[model samples]
Target: MSQNDGTGQKPQPGKKAPSGKTLARRQARTLAMQALYSWHMAGQSLNEIEAQFRVDNDFAAVDGAYFHEILHGVPRQKTEIDGAFESLLDRPLEEIDPVELSILRLSTYELKNRIDIPYRVVINEGIELAKVFGATDGHKFVNGVLDKLAPRLRADEVRANKR
Candidate 1:
């Protein structure tokens, strides 16, 4: 038996419930990932996708601005974001699973544009997103790619952490 961590839900076996801010940010990432997947599959305009998501999902606990930023930013910067870590991929982008690709693109965007977030947090979040939305082993693949991409994009931060 487990106790409710005061969130009206049982905490996972070894994990505490995320703080409100963390939960909001995580919900933002999740919504962004889903929106990205829809955009990739349907070829819809990002604006349409954003508007639809706003209507379809509960945004009350999500960081709406962060979700909006990622949904729009990733596509707007697709070329540069893809180029940033394309060389590190073991396979071509098309060969990669869309779920993994979206997770990668989303995380890579943060690594490149959101300097407020730490590289390790970006990488870890990507892995977590994969575990939830990706293939059985997709988290491993996401980890491998982000692990390589982080040092390249966050060289100073990575090096500082290493010392």
Candidate 2:
């Protein structure tokens, strides 16, 4: 039977069904992680890489606006994001796994800039990304890093949640 593709179209029978986590925002995060990882590994210019990603990826099921926001926003804030993660790191920044680093930086951005989003959600999403994209056992590291970061970045929210 056919499944609903992310873009609101029905998938062809026998085609692989999309995962349950096909919500547009989540898709945007997933894509952002990938694009950020690409930028890190390939050292491509953000504008060129973003343009290429837009041209190459199907955006039907993705939140195009959020995807745009993430890819562009993260690099602009790279110094602060890296500094945040670096403070929480047990090893040198360059030693991190690319996928985990991407997720951590994205999570850090959300924690620092998107105060409307709950810290728990940001940490949880980072964990999920690490689980999906990181090396085996990497999710634990992501969780630990962001768990520490959440309090530093969102002190009031973390304090309130503890109550």
Candidate 3:
């Protein structure tokens, strides 16, 4: 499997380490997903929920900006994200489990907004999230849907780069 650098650049063999901030951003994204899923399940405000999580878990160890941007951005663009998913998935987004839904939302946001991140990396990260947090077959489901959506959403870039 190919590994990525901090700027989302796929590295050749024996390349230097990814920046600390990049690894922190990935961690922050994971924490944000967990936080968002928690809020969705509890029906709590983002601020209240995040603040409580911070106090309880000392999540301040992660980058706050990365956490805030992903959590807020995903929900802010949820309608459009779900629309993309609906077009790609065999079923409605509502039918997906909440954990799987969170993974999809995060991956979709990155695929749409963070063009620096490779589509494959975005999908792989989502699959990893599903493996850790979702049902037995959830990673396959997330991978399938995101794979279909990635080419469509990134058609121009893919065509230009020959991915």
Candidate 4:
């Protein structure tokens, strides 16, 4: 029996499936994380490695340029993101799991760069990614950290938007 057809269950509607843009953003983040993971694993130069990822992953065709922008942008802004994180986290950033670290970096970058994105959505997406990619309890850690950090990271904008 097929997965969806045999359970006597109908697919839920109004669940708000991701738009093409959202899906592309998610794909871009996954690709960027994969690239960063590869770099960490192999210790490759940024230009050499990222170029290879572009070719191998067909990154040019992806829709969410913001994801790629943040992937590259975060490294440049690492000190700021880390400082913000350090101020908010209960423990040092170094103590966090590498997967969780990456999620936080990606989400923080978005929170900073994509002002149009709602802060809650950014936090929720980060928590969801943590659930999938992090160790047990990682989602809680992510949610907690983002909850504290989002207000500071987005600051007056969040207050202005009332999100």
Candidate 5:
């Protein structure tokens, strides 16, 4: 059986250790998901949710600025983000799990607004977030939705990567 490192990361023989910047971004995503879930489920204001995250979570190590952007940006663009997922999804966004919806919104935000980041990277991050925080089978759903979204959002990059 494969062993997990103390941090719950499995040792993959060929996988390189994530760089410091990458780890910080991952943590930022994690925090952003939590903040969004709160907003989606409780109907909290964006400023309130962000302020709560700053007080409740340890932010000294994460990308605080990135977290700020995601937490605010997703809600600021919620109508557009949810509308994008709405077209891709079989049901309304209100039917989605708050956790999964939060992750999706973040991925949607990255795909539409942050083209500097690769589409594959956004999907991988969304899948990871869903696996850790969403329902048991949520990662598969996340994978499916994001897989469909990637080509539409990043056609050139997807076609390039296919080769």
Candidate 6:
């Protein structure tokens, strides 16, 4: 029996279902994390890494613009993004797992620059990324760090949410 896809048609062989905006954004973040991890490990140029990722991945259902934004944005603002959360870390930056570090940097960038996204969402996305890509219990670390960084980055939004 053929199953109906969400679009109400029989699933086509070899065809991927298009993602909703949220899922597309999530895919973007996931890909960005991987690209960031590669850049961190290899010390390669961000442009090269981004080009490689674009060629290697299936972006049909991904948010291409958001993916591009993060792949470039995090590195472009690395110093500020890291500074925003580095002091909150219990250990030295070098001690962080590469995956967790990548997630942290990406989410921190959104928190600081993407004011349209709520601080809670930035934190939640970080936690979710950590759960998916990080070591066991890494989600808690992500949660803690983002929770601390949120207020500093989104003072008015965080303040309004608390009230």
lDDT of 4 by residue, 2-77 (tens): 2232113343465545655766776677667665555555768756767787777765536546545865787778
lDDT of each: 0.92, 0.86, 0.81, 0.73, 0.88, 0.87
- Candidate 3, 136: how far from true, in Å? 1.1
The candidates, ranked best first by lDDT, are 1, 5, 6, 2, 3, 4
Give residue 14's error in model 5 in angstroms: 1.1
Q: Residue 153 error for model 2, in Å?
A: 0.5
RMSD of each: 2.6, 5.9, 4.5, 4.5, 2.2, 6.0
Model 6 spans with C-alpha error above 4 angstroms: 1-19
Best of the candidates, lDDT = 1
lDDT of 6 by residue, 2-119 (tens): 7654334464689665447766787888899999999899999988988898899988978889988998899899999999999999999999999999999999989988998778
Q: Which segments of model 4 are wrong by more than 4 Å?
A: 1-13, 39-43, 58-61, 160-163
Superior candidate under TM-score, 1 versus 3: 1
lDDT string for model 1 (44-123, tens) is: 99999999999999889999999999999999999999999899999998999999999999999999999899999899
> For model 4, what is the alpha-carbon lDDT of residue 163?
48
Query: Candidate 5, overall lDDT?
Result: 0.88
Candidate 2, residues 1-163, lDDT tens digits: the string is: 5466654557567767556444677788988899999999999988888788889988887878888888888999999899987978999998998899999989998898888778998897788788888999999999999999888999999999999
Please report, as a residue range, the 10-residue window in candidate 6 with the lowest summed lDDT.
3-12
C-alpha positional error of residue 75 in candidate 2 after TM-score superposition, expressed in Å: 1.1
Q: What does candidate 5's lDDT look like per residue over 80-105, in tens digits?
A: 88777678886777788889988999
Off by over 4 Å in 1: 1-17
- Residue 91 miss distance in model 1 (angstroms): 1.0
TM-score of each predicted structure versus truth: 0.91, 0.84, 0.82, 0.79, 0.92, 0.86
Clashing pairs in 2: none
Kindly give the stretch of ten consecutive residues in candidate 5 with the minimal lDDT sum: 2-11
**Which scores better on TM-score, 3 or 5?**
5
